[model samples]
Target: MSNAIDFISAYNTIDSRLRAIYRGKGNLQFSDLVRRCAEFNNTVRKYEDDLLLCARLRNVIVHESKKDRIIAEPCDDLTRLIGHVAELLSMPPRLSVLREKNVTGIDAEATLAEALVRIAQTNYSNLPVYRKDRMIGILNNRRVVRVVGQALERGEDVDVFLQTPCSQILQAEDMNRFYRVLGRSDTVQEAIDAFEDNRKLLAVVVTESGDAGDRIVNLLTSADIPMLIRILEE
Candidate 1:
């Protein structure tokens, strides 16, 4: 009975928060509000199954007759469920404003040598390429090396390759293969989905609200996801 009371209390808290969230959006019923919450955020969507189960449990407790003094005993699963819902309601970190490592970028007009030097200094493989405010592409070490190798094979002077403009080596095919851009408001799950959907996708650039024309505010590489998962777990 104590566990059931605690579970009911947690469920009510979640339900009230949900109602407050959707109150101004539209005249949605409780069920519709829950659906909309899942639709609006990928993180919330991840907990959809567990949330729905909580909803059913809420219904059972709220509708119980006055004569029923006892309710279902809570298990470890109930404790976990309450904790997860609380975390979700609190709004997990946003990729746009994450306080992780600073994102570094290079100019499209920068010399190949400049980009190489930056890579060596930062040890960051993925670098966003921008021309002023516009993002042109991402420069990865593999592609940069490949371009230099092709130039050397043609008997071109090493100095010529070093002085070449970064954009000159950026093929249209490479941009499509290596990079994707997401909005600032997009959840981390969206970033994960982008990486999973594109096997060759090496990085995701978070722009102002996910637009390519906006300034790159954050960068997520395949390696960053595991770190992000660890942060979320904590």
Candidate 2:
């Protein structure tokens, strides 16, 4: 009984927050809050299943008469469900969790050898290549290997090939597959979606407003998704 009450309380809290968000967006109608939330791109679109389940549970508890109690004993699953809903509603994790002060980048003028040294020192597979302050491309091991392999196949001197500027290795056709820029306010689910949707996406760069020109706040790779799921589950 206590657990059921707690679940109801959790649902109410979630509903309240959703209502606030809706109103903030100039949506005054609260008759269909769950549907409104579903339509809102920035909030709860990914958690529609969980939200629907909570709505059904809320109905059961709210409509139950004093003489009849349908949810007498709440199990661990119920507790976990409520916890997830609360976390999603109250404080979903953002890209800032991955933010770092020092993000290494290779200058477009830098030699492949310089980029390789940075990669060796940091063990970062994807290094953003910049020209002045603008990001031109990413310097990853696969691209570097491909470029160097082609050079070797053409009988180019290995020493000379290593001195090639980072800009020469950036193929115009392949830039879209390398990385994506996302806003700092974007939810972790959006980041995961970006990776899952793009088979060749190497990294997600978090910036102030998801603009390519904004200063990158953090970087996320495919390996971070599992860790992010664990964090969300907590």
What TM-score does each of the candidates earn?
0.65, 0.67
Candidate 1 residues lying further than 4 Å off, grouped into runs, are: 1-80, 86-92
Residue 181 accuracy (lDDT) in model 2: 84
- Per-residue lDDT tens digits for candidate 2, residues 1-234, read 467777777777877878865665555433367677666433466666667777776676667635565544456687667667766778877777764647789889999999999999999988888888877777889998888899899999989999989998887666577788888888776787787779788888887888876777788889888876665555
- Give stretches of model 2 more than 4 Å off: 1-56, 59-87, 99-101
lDDT of 1: 0.74
Task: Report the lDDT tens digits of candidate 1 across residue range 19-78.
Answer: 765565556655666787776545446666777777777677667625556554557787
Best by lDDT: 2
Identify the candidate with maximal TM-score: 2
Q: Among all windows of ten consecutive residues in candidate 2, which has the lowest summed lDDT?
A: 65-74
